[model samples]
Target: MTIIDYFTQLGSNPYFGAGFGLFGVGAAAALARKGMQVGMILFRRHYMMTLEVPCRDKSYQWLLQWITQHARHTQHLSVETSFQQHETGRVKTSFDFIPSVGVHFFTYRGTWIRVERNREQHTLDLHMGVPWETVTLTALGRDKGIYFSLLEEARSLALEREEGKTVMYTAVGSEWRQFGHPRQRRPLGSVILDDGLGQRILADVRDFIANPKWYTDRGIPYRRGYLLHGPPGCGKSSFITALAGELQYSICVLNLSERGLSDDRLNHLMSLVPQQSIVLLEDIDAAFLSREDTAGVKAAYEGLSRVTFSGLLNMLDGVASAEARILFMTTNYLERQVLALPLSWASDPFEHCSYYVCLCDNFI
Candidate 1:
C-alpha cells in the first residue's frame, strides 16, 4: 500500500473510529452529568423544628432571636417554637414538623445524626418529628451550618431540665454532620462492556438513579450491585460506559490487584463521590484474595472483620453515603459467598451470560 493510500485508509480505520467514538461518548456523558446537576438541588431536604423557646419576650428574647435568625439563614436547618401552654411557674410546649437530613446536638456529641423514626413505638414519646432530605443547591457557607450553634446559644439561656422549667430545644430526626460527601469516590472511567448484557446493565443503572425509591421503598438500602461475566469479546468494559451515561453518575474505577488499600485510603477515595454517581469495583472476586496467596492459590475468605470488609461496608453500608448514589461491582464469576455475607449486602447482582447481543461481525 502506498504511504498516501495507507494514511487515508488509516483515518477511516475501525479502531480509530472506535477510539473517537469512545471519546465522543465520554464527552456526551460529561455533559449529561452536568445537566443532571440541576436536579441535585431538588434532593436538598426541607428542615423544620418545633420547640418551646421562651416567647419573643425579653427573658427569652435573646434565644428566640438567635434561633429565628439562624433558622432564617441555615441551609439544612429550620425552627418553629410556638407559645404553647404558659404557666407563671414555667414554660412547656410542643410542635409538629419533619427534618430529612440529621440532628446536631450542641450539648454533647455534636456530630450530625440521622433521625430514624420508629413510628410504631415512639408515636407518643416525642413532641414533633423532623424529616431530613437530600439537596444539592450550593449550601451557603461553613458558618451557614447555624442550627447547632444556635442551639448552643439557646441552651445557655435555659437553666436546666427541671419539672418547673421548659425545654429550650428538642432535636427531631435527620441531622447534618456536614454539608458534603462521606466517601470520596476516585474518578475511574467507564468500563469496557458487552452489548446485550450491557443494555440490561444500563437499564438497571437508570432505574437506580431515576427512581431510587424503587429500592428504598422496599425498605432496603438504596444501593444495587451488579456482576458482569462473559467470554473476553462480550464487552463487559464498554458496557460500563453506557451504564455511566444512563445513570448520570461518576465512575470510580478500582483495580482488584491494588487490593492492599488501607481502610482510610479507601474511605478517602470514596468520600470524594458527589451526590449521584457510581463507585465501580471491577474484578471484585479477584480483589478479595489476600497477597500471601500466590498465583493460582486463593485466600481463605474472612468475614467483614477484615479491613477490606470494613472498607466495603463503609462504602456499601456506610451511614455517610447519600441515598442516591450507585455502587457497581464487575466480575467474571456469578459468585455468591453466602457464609461470609452480611444482611446489608443482600442486593448484589450475579453475572450471567444468558443475555447476548448481536454485533456487527456476527449475524444470528
Candidate 2:
C-alpha cells in the first residue's frame, strides 16, 4: 500500500478513529472523516457528535432540539451552526459542538446553522460548541472605552429600578447589540457619551438633567436640533463626538439622503429610537441634493416615500412621541433654517416637532 492508502486505512480503522474522536469532536482530522457513522470528535477540549440523516430539515430540527437540551448545563454558551449547501440545491449538515460556558454570554461561530428560510418560517440549529468565552472581555477591557462606557450606563439603569423609577431612552441602531441585552453585557459594556471637556460640559449638564423636556414640554419643540455651521477646521463634528462620549448613548450616524434605507426601516427605526441611545445627523446640508426646498423636505422625510406637507408638521410636534430625545442636526449652508422658527421647511405641518438652533460663522 502507498502512503495515501496507508493514511486512509488509518483513518478508517475503528480503533484509531475512536481514540482520535474521543480526544475531541472539533478535531480537524476527525471532522475530515468521510463515512462518519459513530463516535464523538473532540478538538482543543471542544467536542461534537457526528450525525447524518439524508439532508432532511425535520431530522435537523430533532437533532437541534436534542442539542439544546443536552447543552443546557453550560451557561453563557450557545450554539452556532450552518447548513452545508449541496450542488443540487440540497443541504447537508455537519455536527453540533458542546462549548464551555463562563460568566458572560457568548456565541459560537459554527453554532447557529441556517437550515432553511421561507416566508412562513425560518428554521435554524444552534450548535453548543467552541464557547466565545475563550476570548474574555477582560482582555479587551483597557482598550474598549466605548464598551466600558455602556457598562457604566447599564449599572446606572439597574440602580434606577431600586429607586422605583422608569428608565426611558432613545436608541438609534445597533448600539443595543453591544450593551442592551443581559447576555451581551460583559463584552459590550456601557455606551458613554463624552462631550470631550467633561467638566466643561457640566456648566449646562445640570440644566439638561434637571429638565430633559425643558425644551420639549413647553411645546417649544419635540426635538432638540442643533445646526452646527462654520468654516471647515472647526470642532463641529468633534463637539458632537465629545457629547456622545459623555452621554453614554450610542450614536446613529446617517446621511441626508441614504438610498439603501427602505420605508419600513425608517418607521421601524423611528418606532424603536428609544431603545439604543441617540440619533446624530452630521453635515445635514451636504447629505442631500442642493435643491433647498426639496433637500430640506427630504432630509426631514428620510426613509419614507411621498412625505406630505402635513406629515412633516405632525412629525415636528406629533401625538406619537413622549420620550425625551435629542435629535441633533448639522448644516454648513449659506442661509440656515432655525428649527425654533417655522421657516416653511416643508410648506406643511408635521405631527411632530423637530426643534433646531442655527449656528452661523459668527457663533463658531
Candidate 3:
C-alpha cells in the first residue's frame, strides 16, 4: 500500500488515529522543550556573568561573612551559632544566618544577582572532613567590575572584623587550617621576662622585619630562627604567643612528633606556611632525643614519628625552605645534646635564657 493510502486507512481507525495524534503531540512537545533549552543556554552564555567561589578559597569565608551580614535578603538560611565566655563569668551566644543550599536572589548596587549554593554529597573535602560546597553568583550583563568591587568590600569587612586580633593556625594534612576564632591581641607589656630581655628580643625582631633588604642585598636567606629554652613553667610558650601578637603576625604551630608526618609532608607544610606567620616548634628536643637516635635506630620508636632528624635538618635550611620565614623552637632542656645540631644549622640563632628568681622583703 502507498504511504498516503496507509495513513488514510489508519485515520479511519479511531484507536490508530488517537495513537498517531498522541505521537505527534509528544514529538512537538519534545521539540519545544529542546528549543527552550537551547535558547536559555545561548542567553546565559552571551548575556550573563558568573563567579564561582569554592569553600577552599579564602574569599569563600569573606563572601560568607558578607552574606551573613546581609541575611535578611535571603529566603533560605543556614545558621551558625557560637558562644563566648567573658572574664566576668558571663556567657554570650551569637547566631549567624547565611544563605542556605539553594538558589537565592539579592540586589547589589541596583543589580539583581542570583546566588546558588550547592553541596556535592558524593564529594568530600579531606582537609575539612566535610562535603564539598560551592557558591555560584550569577548576574546579568557582561561587566565584571561589579563583582570585583563586591569582593573588595567583603574583604574589607573581614579584615575589619579581624583587626587587633591574633589568628592561630595548625597543620592538617599538609595544609594550614585556622584553629579557632581569632583571639584578642595580648599586649606585649603584659608578659614579664627577665629584666631587659623582653625589650631586647622585641627590638631585634622589629629590626629584622624592618631590614628585609639588608638580608637580600648580601645574598643572605631572608629568615630568622629563635630558640627559647627554659624550665617547664618558665613561660616559653606564652612568650612566643605574646611576641606573635605584638608583631601583628599569625602563628603556625607544628608538632614534629605528629604520627604519619613524613619528611616530605613536613617539608611541604613548612614551605606552604601562611604569610606573615611565625612557625612554632614547641618541645623541639622531644621530637627526637638525638640525631643518632633517629638515624641508627628505626625500630626503637617505630610508628611514633616518620620524620627523621636528617629530614628535619633539611626542612630547616634546605633548598625548599620558605624565604622570609620566622621559626621559633622552644625546649625545656637546653643542655640536651640533640639541640646541638639544629642550633648550629640555624642561620640566625637567638638563644634566650629564661630563669626565675624570687625577691622578698627582708622583714619577712
Candidate 4:
C-alpha cells in the first residue's frame, strides 16, 4: 500500500498510534539485552585476569628486553630512541619501546593479548584470557617453557655486545654515584706509560684475578694494591680507569679531600662500595695539602677531618677499609722526600708496597 494511503487509514483509528509506540520500545529493549550479553562474555574471560610486573624488578626488565626483541612482529606498538655516551667519548644511539601509558596488542600462541605500560607507576601489565598458559608457566618458573623460550630469544639478541658496560663515578657529597660514561673505551691502551709499566699493570691485574684460590690458601687478604706515582697530566687517572675496563670491573672514584669527609664519614663511604670493584684514591697527598682542603679543614677543623699525616693511612687500611678487589692510589710526587711533608708514606705503606712508578715524560 502507498504510505499516504496506509497512514491515512491508520490515522482514522486511535489504536494505530499506540501500536507504533509499542514497536519502538520493543526494538530498544532487544538492543540493550544484546549489548549486556556481549559485555558479560568479555567480563568472564578477561576481567581480573592480568599480571603486573614493575620496571625496576628483574623480571620486568627481562620482559621489556623480550618485547624489544619481538617488537618487529608486533603490529600495534610505539618506539623511542636514546643516545648514550660510549667509552670512546662518543654518543651511541639505541632504540627501545616507549614505556608510556597505552595498550599494545600482539598475537601469541594463536591467541590475542595486550601489553600495557602504566605511566604514573612504571610497570608492565599483561592482559589475556585463561587459555594463555604461557604467562602462567613463566610466573611459575617452569624451565624450557614458552615464556622462558621467549626470554632466551631476548638474551640471544645481543650476541656481540658484552653483558655489562664499565661505569664511571664521582663523589656526590657523602656518597659515590655513577656520574657518566668514560670516553676511553680502550682503558688498557689509552694510558701513555713511559716504560712497559702499562703491560705490567695489565699482567698484574690478570694474575690477581686468575689466582683467587691461591691467595685464600696462603692466608692472604685476597686483595691487591697498586700505587701510581707521577707528575700531573701524566695519565695516572686515565690509566686507573683503563685498567678497570680491561678487567671488566667497575671503578669507584673517591676524593678524600672533599669537604665534610671525616674519619667516620670516610668509613661509611668505604662500607658502601660495590664488591669486586676498583677503589681509586686520586691525589692522596693533594687532598690533605691542597689550599682548598686546608681552608675547609680549618673552618670545620673541630668537627671535620684533622687532615693529619696519618689520616689517609687510617682511611686506607684497617677494619673500616672496604673489601675491594683492588685498591689504587695515585700521586704526582717523584721523590719520597717531597711526600714526607705530612704522611710519612715512604716509611710505612710505600716501604712494604708493590708499587708502579709511571714516570711520564710527555703529557697527553
When summed lDDT is taken over every stretch of 10 residues in candidate 3, the lowest stretch is 355-364
Cα displacement (Å) at residue 105, model 4: 4.6
lDDT of 2 by residue, 1-69 (tens): 999999999999999999988777657656666425333222312332222222122233333333344
Residue 292 lDDT in candidate 1: 32
Of the two candidates 2 and 4, the one with more favorable lDDT, higher being better, is: 4
Q: Pairs clashing in candidate 4?
A: 87-183, 87-185, 89-183, 187-242
Backbone Cα, N, C clashes tallied per candidate: 47, 62, 0, 4
lDDT of 1 by residue, 1-364 (tens): 8999997997889998889899999999999998787565444433333233222222333453333333333334444444433335465554423222333222213433222212233334232332222211122233444545555665664323222221111111111112111222212244433345555656655655577556656765665555455555555655654555444344556543452455665555555554555556666555555523445544444232234654666665566644554555555543433224454333334334432222111000
Local distance difference test, per candidate? 0.44, 0.39, 0.79, 0.57
lDDT of 1 at 174: 17
Give stretches of model 4 more than 4 Å off: 1-65, 72-95, 103-114, 119-160, 163-184, 187-190, 254-276, 283-316, 320-324, 331-364
lDDT of 3 by residue, 1-364 (tens): 9999997988899999888899999999999999999999999999999999999888998898897776466878888888767768898898988888999888888899999899999999987889999999999999999899999999999889779988999998868988877877877887788776777778877887898888888877777776778888787778778889999999999987788788999999988999999999877666775443556444644456778777877777777778888887777765553335633443332335583111111100
Sorted on TM-score, highest at the top, how do the candidates line up?
A: 3, 4, 2, 1
Model 2, stretches more than 4 Å misplaced?
A: 1-206, 212-223, 262-267, 274-276, 287-290, 293-314, 334-364
Winning candidate number (TM-score): 3
Q: What are the models' TM-scores?
A: 0.36, 0.37, 0.87, 0.54
What TM-score does prediction 2 earn? 0.37
lDDT of 2 at 152: 49
Instruction: Determine the C-alpha RMSD for candidate 3 after optimal superposition of all C-alphas.
Output: 6.6
